[model samples]
Target: MLKGPAGALHVDDGGKGGVPVVFVHASCGNTTHWAAQLAHLRKRRRAVALDLRGHGKSTLDGGGPISVEDFAADVDAVVDGLGLQRFVLVGHSLGGAVTTAYAAAHPDRVVGLFLLDPASDGRVIPAEQAAGLMQALSTDAWGAVIAEYWAPMLAPSRPEVRERVLSDLRATSQVGASAGLGSLLTFDPVTALRRYKGPRLTVVTAFNQEPNSYQRLVPELPSMQVDGTGHWVQLDAPDAVNTLLDGFLSSTT
Candidate 1:
């Protein structure tokens, strides 16, 4: 029953009244991707996890050419639909690009932003590299794409975590994954980040998988390292991310 610009936003809401905190997932990820964070933050603050359009249960009206703006608009539509005023934005990878665009578009509405292994304009893979990656995806019939991408984002703590991550990814529809990849490949959030006036925190993974452009673009912005995690830091090291999130949100609030 979540109405938005495109259509309904598939979301999970928790907590009573405090500042609302929204969790935005990376490409190919849905609301379930933020399960760990939602469980941790919802107890203290209003937490909402949204499944981006074309992903999860969200239904879209005439899916058009995908772009970063489209994703940002969906998020804004959800916020407006919920009648939320001030809130914190937590974005991962492709979600970071969307949140950056949204915050820039509505600077006054965003109190803070926590980016987990965000992608950047400067760090985009060379056209050839991207083409190769795309080719790899096309070649894989069974679609082992998730494993290739999720390697760096997991902690060595438990073998069960790997199985869980794979299961969560497989739960998403292939159509949703491909559609999201279309938008992600074209998104560059470096310029968008420059436009955000709110407090920002970028959490880099320990595997050195983060783009070098992020290092250059966010020179002044404070960043922390999450040991033994990949692009999906929340999944690999939820406790550490939660601790960092709690501190950041507390300071900003």
Candidate 2:
């Protein structure tokens, strides 16, 4: 545990070797969310997983509603505390939004980028749906809503994967998730990304794996697809995701 701007943050350090890869988990998620990615990536390079301010081990009681900046601050603390010179930033879902914010603000510190089925443009998540989700959280109905919505979308095939996803979602604090969702609404990756010019790779589910799915992120940041996976592509196809990351990291000459 390290005392960051947001207090003590739970960070999983994979030791030293190659350029470090910092993994960020999605909202309503913890360090465990990146279990597969860190496990595989760490073998080759220093892979680190962190629990955002309000998630997992960093579950501090106060943090003024989660926002991209808040998430970025956590990463800031991690990087500074660890004395990392340069590293690759990997974020999933909401974590990707935070990664974009960080890379935009600190492009020099980042050597590479990977956004895994992340939520970037506002159009990605319907306004009506976002409002409805917040309303559900307001009513203390997160459990029911998670089963009804996310389970089918994220855990369609794998039973064990589904359970862990739900467990993490439920473990997430309602306050943090709701605020983070609102922040996502105001997030503009297009603007943030404009500041950061580095090797880019955007991985998305095979279903929505196309130029249009990423919209502006397409030509700016070359993208790829993970077959037979959902939003939690890392959980469903870690090997495929690992292969993609390895290829991108090694091929970047």
Candidate 3:
């Protein structure tokens, strides 16, 4: 575990001396969420997953305001602390937004990026449409919120995959869910995407619940879509996600 400005980040390091691949999980997620990917890819490459502030082992009992930049800074701190060179940055959900912002802020540090169901374009549901979902998350069905919202973002072929994602969702606290979702509501990574020309690929689930914010990037970036998985595609479709990531990493680097 490594300490950052926000809290202690739990990281898993694997592989020998290849370029490092660091993963940032979505809101309400911890490093454990990336277990499937870690288990599969660790033997071939160096991999690391971080628990964002207020999530997982990194708790913010009374931390200051949490901005997208602050989250990006935490990522920067980790990379610098590790003395990593020639690496790829991967992010999912809100972590996607953080990775994009980090890549934009420090383009030189990034060799490529793999964004899984990323939140770069911002919330697709309007404030009005999200009201009900928000209320449900705050009052009842917090776990359901994670499942339902991501259900639309995943491919429909995987029945067993849903349970794995649900387990992680159930672990997220109400305060973290509300606060983390709130942070995502205000973040917009469109400008950052435009500025970054490095090898960038975005993987969107076939049943994307949010609007096609990924489309907005088509003009400025390179991206693709995967089926049979949800917003938490890494968990629901690790094999497919890994295939895409391995190919992308190999091509970009």
Kindly indicate the candidate among 2 and 3 with the higher TM-score. Answer: 2
Cα lDDT tens digits, model 1, 67-175, are: 7778888898888888899899998877888888899889999999888877656336678876666566555442486566666556454577677667766766555
Error of 1 at 54 (Å): 2.2
TM-score of 1: 0.87
Residue range 48-106, candidate 3, lDDT tens digits: 87777667776555533466777887788677777786689999888888898898888
Q: How well is each residue in 89-191 modelled by candidate 2, as lDDT tens digits?
A: 9998888889989999999999988889887565467778878777786777766765675654575448788888888777777776666666776677777
Ranking by lDDT: 2, 1, 3
Candidate 3, superposed: residue stretches over 4 Å from native: 63-65, 123-148, 154-159, 209-211
Cα lDDT of model 3 overall? 0.73
Q: How close is candidate 2 to the true structure, as a TM-score?
A: 0.89
Evaluate all candidate structures by whole-model CA lDDT and list the values in order. 0.76, 0.78, 0.73
The residue pairs found clashing in candidate 3 are: 152-207, 153-207, 154-229, 154-230, 155-228, 155-229
Best by lDDT: 2
The runs of at least 3 residues in candidate 1 whose Cα sits more than 4 Å from the true structure, single-residue gaps closed, are 61-64, 120-123, 132-142, 155-157, 208-213
The number of the candidate with the highest TM-score is 2
- Total clashing pairs in model 3: 6
Model 3 error, position 75 (Å): 1.4
